[model samples]
Target: MTNKPKPVIGITSGDLNGIGIELIIKAFSDQRLLDFCTPVIFASNKVVNFYRKTVTESSFSFYHTREFDKINPKQVTIFNCWDEEVNITPGVLNETGGRYAVASLQAAIEAFKEKKIDGLVTAPLHKSNVQSESFSYTGHTPFLKDSFGAPDVVMMLCADNMRVALVTEHISVSAIAQHITAEAILSKLNIINSSLQKDFGISKPRIAVLGLNPHAGDEGLVGNEEQTIIAPAIKQAKNNGILAFGPYSADAFFARGQYEKFDAVLAMYHDQGLIPFKSLAVGEGVNFTAGLELVRTSPDHGVAFDIAGKDRADAGSFIQSIFFCADVINQRSEYADQRSNPMRKIAPDVVSRLADEKIEE
Candidate 1:
């Protein structure tokens, strides 16, 4: 049998004024990454060269193409999205940056629809800068959900062994309590459990649920979200054959390193989970969107405008995101194959007969 072809990965060039392009160039500078997947960057040659000059000694090279059919698998492919003359001011926020960022994303989304790419690894884009009437959303998760028609998606942060999935993302803290319902929590738990099994190859994922309130509402004295909202969700998850346990105090849980005991942790809101994840991830974390047919991962850190053009951005997380995307693509394919033709156990008598037949042969 022959080996499978390398997966085609689509990468979006985020915020021209930020460090998105720099990170992409730095990550792909190492030719060794090409052995795993064929990378197709959705940006014009001009935009890439603007930052390529700033990376000190970047050896990144690419094949420029206007048609998807002409993508070269041997080297990186720069799928030119546009050919307009625009000023690129690094470390500055402007409409030009936002407009072109959207263009790149739309181009990548089109490629995804055509099935030209197996997975996506997006560079960070500023939430405020990318906001326009036509593309108004908090961040990539919701935008992607609408683009792909996925009912809902979970924002999961991954670093080594620790995985944290958020039930609520990019919402105001004042409104967080209102959204933490039993149904919502249960939905996130289901997605995390399924992603762990299918994407991460966990046969039975053990999920730890974090509470919305401090000290887990102190058993209902500080708040009742744990008892009323979170507890019911955990109970229902267990009933549904998911081994989910929690309503654990967010402080004590991380303070004691309890996240290592489970496959994934479900946090009630954004900062509640991300703060701890970023602190512990030590620049090795990446953001993965679960509960979608398409696989998407991004660098855990955002567009660092302060350090933009300084060549100070670390590409570790960006590189890891690519690795994560490829791993998930391969895992999902293997999962589909196994489910399509599962192995059957032979009975004792059948095994004996098969053994005797083999011996006679």
Candidate 2:
């Protein structure tokens, strides 16, 4: 019998000046993480070392590699981009750090394309500091989408069991009204539905779509967007057998524990979804990019410039992101393996029957 290969998770260190390196070091230091997947950090050795010394006490050694063949699971592996030289200060942002950050992300994307890694988890990066004019695409979601030729992508933030997906991300509040359309909402719903089923192992996913206006337009008294745009999209998605329903008022819905009823909630804009989500799961939230050929997730928070070098950055979100990536990869592998073996189908039924029999006793 051949042993299955362990899933390799590629992690990109975001901005050198921020807490990206610190969180990366703290996350990898947890020996418990190695039980699930092999983690490979796509970064430079000097940057990692500098953060370790400045932020926390270092115990583990990082094996620096220029090629995939040099990766070793027993040691924390660092894939050196060798992109450029930068004197990485703990709390100051620099163009050199930005350039290296972009290079690290590009290297990870190439590794994913080459089938060297199963999924990718990224740290936060500064948009203002990166060197290339062409890299002006907000955050990692758009960058990854354009890199892989995926025209449509959705950003979902997961906090424990509850999940919220954004229909429009990284756009201004003024532009959101123009961007909200039936096609756009339907596309995001499809991506969320498919992702919950395939990646999350949810057999039948239930999605809730939030309204564009307060009180869901109060029957068109407050705003007509819920009637003219959102309701039509929800109806369309349901007609296509997506199990989608909503146009629910954003304020009252979350306050009433309505989010627990669905597997994922689709918000019309960025802050409309994220504000409540972060309030509920601030330190533990993990941001996941859906609708990509490859899986990508990140810590939901940004660079804490105030306490960047103070050793006060919490690694909870970063740790959760790694575990979430591992869980998704495992589910995908398990589903594929079951499809290859017909006998595995009966295992669930057999277990169910045994449980029923025991209940009668």
Off by over 4 Å in 1: 344-361
State the lDDT at 27 in candidate 1: 90
Error of 2 at 281 (Å): 1.2
Predicted structure with the largest lDDT when compared to the true one: 1
Give a tens-digit lDDT track for model 1, residues 110-212: 8999999999999988888888887999988999999999877899999896999999999899999889899999889999999999999898999999988
Error of 1 at 39 (Å): 0.2
Give the lowest summed-lDDT range of ten residues in model 2. 52-61
Error of 2 at 302 (Å): 0.9
In model 2, which runs have C-alpha deviations exceeding 4 angstroms?
1-3, 338-343, 355-361
Using Cα atoms with residue i matched to residue i, what is each candidate's TM-score against the true structure?
Answer: 0.94, 0.95
Residue range 1-361, candidate 2, lDDT tens digits: 3657667999998887888889988887777788777889998887787777875564656788888997887677899888455687767778866787898899999999999999999999887787477698888999999999997989999987589999889888889999999999999999999889778988789999999988889999999999998999999998998999889999998999899999999998999898999999967999999899888899998877777878889999999999998888877776776779856766878989999999999
Prediction 1 global C-alpha lDDT? 0.91
Quantify all predictions' global Cα lDDT against the true fold.
0.91, 0.87
Give the Cα error of residue 51 in candidate 1, in Å: 0.9
